[model samples]
Target: MTKDTMSIDTSAELLENDILPMIREVHTDPDVPCASQGDMPKALAEPVAKKSPAQWAYERIIMYIQNFEKQLDNDHEVGMGLAGGNTGVIRIEGLGYYDPDIVTYYGTSEAGAKTQLIQHVSQLNVTLIASPKHIDQPEPKRIGFRLAAGLERSEDVTT
Candidate 1:
């Protein structure tokens, strides 16, 4: 078989033999729902041989953020609390990964000023918080979907 065919076969085998089984075994809090098989993006199902650690971390984080957002009410949006130091919370507006080992966040602070944080994959620690939506906004922003869509678009462009 050609190299591309071989790679496709390997990926299908891996998904059936490894990824699907593991996903089935995943457990979560009774009150908090997790991503179902259908909810997972296709990019996540297909394994990439040379994916960087940063890219892997970024994808997993996006999955988590998406799941968490599903548990929020319309009045609340996702915010991230940084660990260590006196760094405060930020409303997560955007996310990006730098190849090799870096993840970056762009958002607004508690005071509503623009903020950005960059961290190495090793030191990455994020606590998702439910912050109240702005008074003028009719509903909380569901960033998880947007972020996941962006990730898929980036994958499409790269491929």
Candidate 2:
């Protein structure tokens, strides 16, 4: 037989016997090498939650403050208020001249000299600057702070 006729006859024979590679509706395990597109298992993907840069900085600042508070000596006391209705004061006690560990100050006029002494103490100086640069933004909503500890030691002073 001629080559063309011989190839056509062979193809016809293969088709009749169902020996050609035909598509099969097979369900295979993902681990198997012969797994088809539909038979392959889905990937175990997880979604990650993202936080804004400002929010991330805020969280980090909070964590750092918390850790610092935890490491502080138990004998110390902390007091907070605004100075002259403008500057914010974070008072750290136990570093003052008062016999008691804590010292309370009101508006600098009330405890002006004592407050100055407290501010100068190397051990009890807790300065927190809430600059707009901390969050890398020119503007921010009303800033707020929390005192997890301190405001203890009602030990001394007047007014």
Candidate 3:
């Protein structure tokens, strides 16, 4: 099966434009369903607290980035199921040139992953493992990115 890939900018503008609408739908439409609390163990799923839409969006984005980082660090398959039977694998890292070891550790190479750290804004590439049964949909929630190491260090220094 062929994977359809998309490069997305995870900047505030893009998030507001591409992602927020779908998120609004998920939260407001009772039929659409919020993220499944059922899949989680009872201990984890119980005591679900309500949050504002902005907080929910922020939390969801943070969770996606953190999960992606864990998958990269552990060398696990970094895939998430999207709507309509399509699955996607996400890769994100710091901006700028990285040593070969860093690239290798992150399971991406200069040719593949080192294209940009934070060119216009934070960016990510999503490779969708799609089949004929899968229909494409806007899934901004699936994409994530993190600050580049260099950028983080610089900010730390300035602070």
Candidate 4:
């Protein structure tokens, strides 16, 4: 099958053989494959980022469509959403995200930045998710081994 049609469900394995060796990060060996999307950090998402808040809000609503598709592919009895992967609405004033089942963000501000996001994850029964992106700083936590361990348990995860 062409790479395009190759199933990503087994991406965990493809990651081990095809993608890991060339990586520069010492901790990024085959055992822990990074983002399924690849080095998204190197690829600028600014054009997509420039979209207005309204646009972001709209696009996010359907981010979980594929996950739903997977659930449909199953017999429909058992679904996974209570552990490390789950999606829910995150409301921050004029912002909203129907986040994918694997993203977690926390902020620390007058609005309870660090605490609020931590509380949200705790309530959801999720213990880990992908790291948030920031244009200004390099978050070592998002790099490799750290990411795998940083948010292992959602209850205590915070910036």
Which number leads on lDDT? 1
- What number of clashing residue pairs does each candidate have, in the order they appear? 0, 0, 2, 5
lDDT of 4 by residue, 38-137 (tens): 3332112223434443333222322222222222312221112233433332222111223322233333333333323332322444222222233453
TM per prediction: 0.78, 0.23, 0.22, 0.20
Q: By the TM-score metric, which is better: model 1 or model 2?
A: 1
lDDT of each residue in 11-67, candidate 1, tens digit only: 668666545424443566565576653456766765555477787778778888888
Please, what are the lDDT tens digits per residue for candidate 3 over residues 57-155?
233443334444433322232332223332233233222222211111122232344322221112223332212211243332223234212122322
- Top TM-score hit: 1
Where model 1 places Cα greater than 4 Å from the true spot, the runs are 1-31, 151-159
lDDT measured at residue 5 in model 4 versus the true structure, 0 to 100: 84
- Alpha-carbon local distance difference test for all models: 0.79, 0.30, 0.30, 0.30
Residue 62 Cα positional deviation in candidate 1, in Å, after optimal superposition: 0.9
Residue pairs in steric clash, candidate 1? none
Candidate 2: residue pairs that collide: none
